[model samples]
Target chain A: MPGTETAYQPTDRTVPTRSRERAAYDRELVHAILDAAYVCHLGFVRDGAPVVLPTLYGRVGERLYVHGSTGSRPLRMAGQADPGLPVCLTVTHVDGLVLARSAFHHSLNYRSVVVHGTAHQVTDADEKRTALDALVDHVVPGRSADSRPANGKELAATAVLRLDLAEVSAKLRTGGPNDEPEDLGLPHWTGVVPVRTAYGAPVPADDMDPSVPLPGYLAAL
Target chain B: MPGTETAYQPTDRTVPTRSRERAAYDRELVHAILDAAYVCHLGFVRDGAPVVLPTLYGRVGERLYVHGSTGSRPLRMAGQADPGLPVCLTVTHVDGLVLARSAFHHSLNYRSVVVHGTAHQVTDADEKRTALDALVDHVVPGRSADSRPANGKELAATAVLRLDLAEVSAKLRTGGPNDEPEDLGLPHWTGVVPVRTAYGAPVPADDMDPSVPLPGYLAAL
Candidate 1:
């Protein structure tokens, strides 16, 4: 089933066994989580074992393009005659450290989105170029227009795996620690320490002429 | 063979097919990358399909412990009457966004470690407790001693999987973007926009007593 208009229906694979309350299938939430993060952990099976690697990804509507080189095994697999490479792509943002009164209750405040689907190589030249632009813009929104697009040689050397954002779920844990009633009186301090990604001033290339000013979009970061 | 006195020998799975120059097997580098992060993407095979999930993990010397509930399928599989589960655990920290002259050359400055090995359920109660403490302290070192240790009931409720750090590699990208000679002359603003994890002031739990001050370890973060 395509699910309702607002949310994707949860499937067995997308539903977590524990902490079921934290999982959500709202399409907007999924997109928000995916769009906010540029790096993703991509998992694929090889030689009957799981391999997880961190890579850059870009989301265009319901599809995700993972940047990789053509020499990579997973990318080669997707380009092969095989149907497609089944993968699990996950992105997470740790919001805070949940320090509870008891060690058992200690946890992290995080928002994570997991997508289960098959990834295929983007063989279409136009789609591949679009995906590359999306990947660049993902790192810094509107960056593709500021930089030179991939040339023919560069495009042919690169590999892009497009994974549709179907069978997706987002899990979140926020607020403060949930210590037990008995442990509340303990001497230990309980609270949440907020965590975030901070960006420092951009450094200009040593060889660049001073006249080339920072882009307005990157300056905003 | 154990490659050297201070580095783990490279296994087939630990080597990167591409960007081979960025891969390192130095034990110290691997430990540093693993210790600095609390969350990891744990990958395992489920029904012959790869599944990756974001979870908290702790490192004790050469052993890495992943926190999970007994109800989870991977944990259950590790506890079942069978060989250890083949898993790949990865931790990544995006240091900065490398804005290159060309979109094709754009990349991220990141440090990551990938461990591919078998994970066994920590059946020993002592090790499990130690792992739990390590997991807590990994979030904020020395905070484990400041908080109440898990009770017997809590210990029994949690499930842990221990993976030895035998096959491992640390991949890193630092410095600025490496744009091509021809593209360097372009007007594009090129350089690395540094990124880092920043921690804000800790917020006390609503129910906590005002007298209990923040611990020194957490305050340092």
Candidate 2:
């Protein structure tokens, strides 16, 4: 465990072999990165091979929840009586394209969090409801309250997996390219092209009433 | 094999358990999806557990190249004698937010490509050079020619792994939210919020000549 409450302890698996300076164990940074993304790449072993799938996820405190139909492979695997399915969930945001004068120095400015742990199915009724709401609200803040909650039948069909954020690390690269001193004078434009997620105007459903006003939470996006 | 050259034959793993309608084996669609993203979540088995990592990748024809320092674990694993390292490379682009009347129906409009294959280290110098050039060009079209090629020392330090895109599938969700007929009358806003990747103005390195005009390709972004 970490000596401080605000950070997570570095584990053998979480410590990167190279560029150790890029890794962070700050708890808040991990939560912020996880909450900002709408989807996460969840990886698990199947038949002795690795399988990675993009899925919706929600972070409630230090616990991360991912849901799918009960028949889904990962969820079903997590439901097994075994301690849980070992999974590595990762979230990444590309902030910029780092172009260097030397081809060897080219890299991307990105922030990514990697979680290594076992994922168990959420069995309690109330906890599953909280996860379901978090899943909906994670997409659009205050969405669960605005939309109708899942009915009993819908709840039964869904399987929620919970992974505690005990072993995690965020790796990031920022600023411009790191070109060598000799290559600085090369005749190539060297810089960063900033990349961001942009949200466009919302289009109402055709079946809905045109008078229905846009909610404040969505407009805030 | 696919009945025609225009598509990929979906294997058991490429075929999704649910939402089969969203799966596409079209070759061009798969390439377009792969070309649009800068980062991919790469999964490989590590120490008998699943490990997922976000890394930069370049797609050339039917092959995907991922590079890192020769000391990296995955690269070292791929360099081993037996066959190659089994990997699952997935790229996802969240196109829009699907807001439905019922929580159960909420989803994200996304385009994703999943490639299931074995990765082998590129030991041939010529192939490695081509893969490195492709990686640089993938960041910004027409960039490799403008930049200085990697030197002998740099080329020897970096390692590139090649994975052919023979087993691939593209899954996409588009348009607005799909609300149930009965729930359409709920007192909530229903619509689709478009999400896109926006590129910002390029920022040159502090040491770069201020007079260097921005390249046409970057300005076009």
Candidate 3:
């Protein structure tokens, strides 16, 4: 899964008319972008209207897995429909604020991945367990090995859905803002204020045993 | 906008099937969650399939505005459709990662807002200008006041769409993970690793005039 090279072919649906130069088809770039983010916006059509909800996701090679309660709308819909649920999943990270001389040119330097495909409910028990493990490890590395695996009851209540990384594109906007030549002379600061996502020290739960200490994996973060 | 109190009536679309206890209909809570995030996932149907896009947005009172080049597919479709574009807009902030004793109970403490409505193309020139100003100011406070406004040509090429906050809900997961009682003694480290978004030092542009310095608004950040 690591160091694999496969560029997805751009389709009519994946192509953007504006700023086409920012789009990328490289597999490594897509995987890196997807791995960096913690959550994704899952979009599906309901009654001919689109509905987008934020949810956690995990990626393993060419497949992405998202899990939710069996009673959840998307999971239920996926199981009920004859065909799989058509969905669009997207992840984005804003790296910096691009401030320009002109307000019109002000923008954000960001990296985003958009995945379009039909998601089918994962049925196999082993695959479901693996997908759930991936989801846990996705939020924090080495997490899956540290925590207890799900039991049969818990596994039954959870529903995992998988989407192949076939129709995917990564778009990125980087560097300083592109201000007009005339506006460059204007008396305004022009630059990027970088944005960073950092993890803070862990806070123990109220009911946790005091004998247990902070783990090395979390302390490193 | 500050200290306003209004509660939205929860409809079936706004209610969550699972974890209903986390849902909130208070307008102030919804506004706070929306204001904290920089980007939103805009979802709409295209050719009977759902499409989700990450875009910049601005909120003014009960209305939200999203803008893009006229050539963009979503913007063009909104302008062409008489009834406007049926869309869903969502914003999410992941505050912390919850590592439970059991892997099944591991989750993220997050605040999210979901909005569903029809987005109409902004037709009035004055509203369009105001909306554009909001977009700039949204990214950086006091930015629109310091920078040059868009000219006629730039204005013509851009389209702004407005969505009223009629159908909205905010969901939040706080505190520690809900691990099962029997798993409390599991050897895994269990706690909340806080996640935070912060700004770094501003990087001046390559060709910027040296005389101009970073503005107070950005410096404070």
How many pairs collide in each candidate, listed in order? Answer: 0, 0, 0
B1-221: candidate 3 lDDT, tens digit per residue: 53344887788899999999999999989989988876999999999999999999998889999999999999999999989999999999999999899988999999999999999999999999999998888888789999989999999999999999978999999999888989887777788999989999999998889889779999877
DockQ of 3: 0.86
lDDT of 2 by residue, A42-141 (tens): 9998888889999999988888999999998898889984999999999999999998999988898988999999999999999999999998888899
Note the residue pairs that clash in candidate 2. Answer: none
Query: Tens digit of lDDT per residue, candidate 1, span A1-221?
Result: 44345887789999989899999999999989888889999999999999999999998888999978899988997888378999999999999999899998888899999999999988899999889989888889999999888888888899999998889999999999998888888999999999999999999878887899989998788
Every model: iRMSD: 0.7, 0.8, 0.9
Residue A142, model 1: Cα distance from true site in angstroms = 0.7
List the candidate 3 regions with Cα displacement exceeding 4 Å.
Answer: A1-5, B1-5
Residues B1-221 of candidate 1 have per-residue lDDT tens digits of 44346999888888888889999999999999999999999999999899999998999888999977788888998888378899999999999899888888888999999999999989899999889989988989998999898888888888999999999999999988888888878998988899999999999999989999778898799
Q: Which should have the higher lDDT, number 1 or number 3?
A: 3
Clashing residue pairs found in predicted model 3? none
Q: A113-211 in candidate 3: lDDT tens per residue?
A: 999999999999989998999999889988899889989999999999999998999999999989887777888988999998889999998778888
CA lDDT, every prediction? 0.90, 0.91, 0.91
Which docking category, incorrect, acceptable, medium or high, applies to candidate 2? high
How good is model 2 by TM-score?
0.98
